[model samples]
Target: MPTHQIQIWFTCTVDDFSSSTLAQTFSTINENIQQVLNPLDAICHKPREDAICVSQLRNAKKVDEAILQERPDVKIFLPFRFLFWKPQDLFRPNTYNRFLAATGGDHVISLIDEISFRFPPSPPLSQIDDLPQELFCNGDNRPADCGPNCECVHQVDIPLNAIVEVVLVDEVQSPNLSHPFHLHGYSFNVVGIGRSPDQNVKKINLKHALDLDRRGLLHREFNLPPSKDTIAVPNNGYVIFRFRADNPGYWIFHCHFLFHIVIGMDLLFHVGTQHDLPPVPPNFPKCGHHLPPITFDSGYH
Candidate 1:
């Protein structure tokens, strides 16, 4: 693929565009065409600690000290400062983008620190159909365009037996937040995770040499094993997971960071048809709907 030569020609006349904007956009189209390029590092690496905070993390917190003592490789636990000038889909008229601003609307979007999720000890999540549908999904299945100022987004529904590939990204704005997402009801095969700004590769099988070579790299692996309920999305990086829709029920896929979900970094997948839903437990007890307790620790709150 690297040995190929490609050409592109574009022409814009005075009638098609205003002169000022066109001049600003087209003046920087520099291209040094090459017949060959260097091979990319098969393994993806995390951003360097020096590159974590935009200001270089001049002031250290107790949490930072504690993190250094424990996970020394980790610099800090904060959402990455974005690189793009604005959030994706900022000007759309969709219900999701109704409240967004130029810089994602809220400067403190993922700014919260330290969170926890605790369920009641009695009614286990396995109770399934017994709980109110609200417990599984807060909003009905619809086209929820989360953006500019949205606090929460809508859930996605999938038919039974359908196969889904979730491409979760750190996004251009919060590129530094490393989310360790977890999927309920089913475990998925992680395809790959990488930090390259521009990555392009076709899906490769796990047993193939391309997959086997990634087993040891600390960065992203091309062929990742399929046993984890949760996996880390490297800071300033991304990861992809694939799963089948055989688990006919409502399930939540969210970042392991409790605070991220609180600020709306979550999604729901409804597997199969309504007929696929199992009846509630026969002797289930009734109780009011409840939201779990969240506590902020360290200096994060």
Candidate 2:
């Protein structure tokens, strides 16, 4: 649903009675939206230097950049200037330790709203001969020891020294909360930003076609970008950025909100090969359960 609903729609009208608080809020919203758009002057359309558009959406289907160059009919990209998507975080050494202590290894929250979206989904116990019996399903024919449905935390691995491009879409599941995404080791250049596709529910199954259209639009619309380590992914909005995966360690990508974190909006990037990484120092204190026995003679498993 979040992926399908990408565009925005709005209505404006002056009310007979006025509330100062509501007026200020609406005015701020109008300015923020306008700031995200680019100047439409002829000079502004001149080619930019040192910036490359990501020709693809690197998901399972692997939408590539060639499409942008190849297709002129797609209308998803509208011109955009990312000067306003700036990072506004502040450093506070006074609360650093307190913040760290609060977030220490507290991933005990239960995942109650998980789903497996396989069409004509296979039974958990269904098996093939080549792979280990326990590889996908357990003895009871359940998906895992948890029986039929144990979901692992979602994660992404970026190859060492590789350049990374990430496209993020926000649906604002929680009201009044913006996720100020922060990466631990490296910052990113905000290369492109675009409006959501008209998220009409009936248009959802039209996702693949919609994405192709939307991405093409973003490619054509990209303009005057900015770079940063942290930026707000506005509620019900989208952002696209790029960075090099040179940080050879397990780095975190998370929201700035303390409460939002405890409930588990987090992702980890295991960058680089084990050989490319530094050796673990002696007695790096173990966390709960340590790690599963990893047979990594070449590098970390």
Candidate 3:
């Protein structure tokens, strides 16, 4: 588990008419807090000028100031940084209502691995209900026909330490959002992204297909180690990475593209122990029940 503190300073200006909506907004925030934490205890919701300050994990005055100055109704704000014993992802539902009330979206930060104490684990189905239907109901083009366990195999755990290898390749071209990429159950290391100039682009009439795998310029670079969640890939370059897939679960590795993924450009990875993958379903051979071989080849095909 890793932790990142996020301070959100936001102002909700209220006019006479805005009061009703504001009340509704506050109700949503308060409900989230009650459902997730003890309001009088872990969570705090306070008003500051036209703003609200929310601190999770370590606090930074700079993050607060920058967020506040983004608007005028905002006023003084600061967060008292603190580290805790058990690292509950501060992003979990309702842990911080002030931030929720302000951001009004599904954004959160991991503060640590595992909650401080184990309560009766919520039923898996209950947790599944909380997830967006598109995530597994297949609206996202995910193959999960029904919810978890509805599929033939009941395997539903994501290993946190299963080793994985990744390679990202890009062709020389003007930057454009190419694909909506996604990792499986885990994120990986950000090795680096290099670029090369293409004199070929300067010429016209010599028709050229934009190759997404052309390599060489050596522009911006990153060398961070592995972690969980999304890691960005450059628009016109390559990214190489490695990660562990210790978690045992059915995971999807695909571009986030809603339609593109439905067509193709999506694959799956099974990070089981060194043991060979289970046999593919007799009926759906194209579905690939096993892991794909890891290769880092890059070239126009």
Winning model by TM-score: 2
Using lDDT as the measure, the top candidate is: 1
Candidate 3 per-residue lDDT, tens place, 33-130, comes to 21321111211222222221111122222222222221222111101011221224444675531111113333221110110111112222223333
lDDT of 2 at 290: 32
What is candidate 1's lDDT per residue for 115-205, written digit by digit as tens?
1122222342345445544332222322245233433323456777655555444442233445667888987655555544333433222
As a whole number from 0 to 100, the lDDT of residue 223 in candidate 2 is: 30
Instruction: Give the Cα error of residue 96 in candidate 2, in Å.
Output: 30
Model 2 pairs whose backbones collide? 6-196, 6-197, 7-196, 7-197, 55-64, 55-65, 56-65, 76-217, 77-217, 77-218
TM-score of every candidate relative to the true structure: 0.43, 0.45, 0.31
| Model 2 agreement with the true structure over 221-255: per-residue lDDT tens digits | 32323446786654444555666676786566666
CA lDDT scores, all candidates in order? 0.41, 0.39, 0.31
| CA-only RMSD, every prediction | 22.2, 18.9, 23.1
Candidate 3 C-alpha error for residue 32, in Å: 34
Better of 1 and 3 by lDDT: 1
